[model samples]
Target: MNSDLLILDYEPAHQPAFRALNHEWIAHYFTIEPIDNEMLDDPEGYILAPGGHIFMASHGGAIVGTCALIKEHKGVYELAKMAVSPRAQGLGIGWALGQAVVAKARQLGAHRVELLSNARLRPALALYAKLGFRHVPVPPTPYQRTNVKMVLDL
Candidate 1:
């Protein structure tokens, strides 16, 4: 736990790590089945596209966490795809990544930042609350898989 955790922009070579993080998070946290190839392929375009940024945290040269910011509307961004490796949890990595994304949102002059999460993700819910994200009764998502939506005013 004394190792330095480096946070930097996502790299093309780190796509597999990012994919693995996403897959594990969704499957384990959401209790959903693993993603298929098509779903896995979807992140490539976003990770490599403009108007979005990916930040990753590495410990001991291993990618332990990742977070992404994608433009949602005129003045809002979606804080999507945040995950920390199970072995690396409870180390404040998620809080650091959350602050990084909020800083990025402010840099972009975003009015608000939003994220969706499942009700069962209590740790994430607490983290979001600690970071000033207020829950909304209804979310903007069409999918019913998520029950909690929180927005941070920037």
Candidate 2:
């Protein structure tokens, strides 16, 4: 990771950057679904208000990556909306953000953390695996693009 890269908590000022980063990645691989719009449009309502958290990675004073842990009932969090700017892809921003979110979930007393992803996103899946997430049976999901599910026990 870059020595200057910092993972910070989300604030209202980060709304546009958060949405743009996520939209850029999702649209590149799959169609943006209604659920994506709902979450991206009002992260505070759908995520933070429910006791979840969002983390942003800043490098050279620019937002370069983001990740979120959405509370899903007691002691469970869904790792979602992770993205790294194309320019920052090789700087380990994604790993830093992922570690931050997982650490946050554990700090919040989460028993498990799960994520929904696509098989085609091999790099992401590898990252998740490296973070201690293991493949699990895919549950029905709102996003048409999701075909892989993984979980990490805390």
Q: Best candidate per TM-score, number?
A: 2
lDDT for each residue of candidate 2 in 1-154, tens digit (9 for 90 to 100): 6888999999999999999999999999999999999999999999999999999999999998899999999999999999999998988888898899999999999999999999999989999999999999999988899999999999
Clashing pairs in 2: none
lDDT of 2 at 91: 88
**Candidate 1, residue 4: CA error in Å?**
0.5
Tell me the lDDT of model 2 at 12. 94
Candidate 2, which segments miss by more than 4 Å at Cα? none
Q: Which runs of model 1 end up more than 4 angstroms from their true locations?
A: 1-3, 31-40, 47-50, 140-142
Candidates' lDDT values, in order? 0.80, 0.95
Worst 10 residues of 2 by lDDT: 88-97
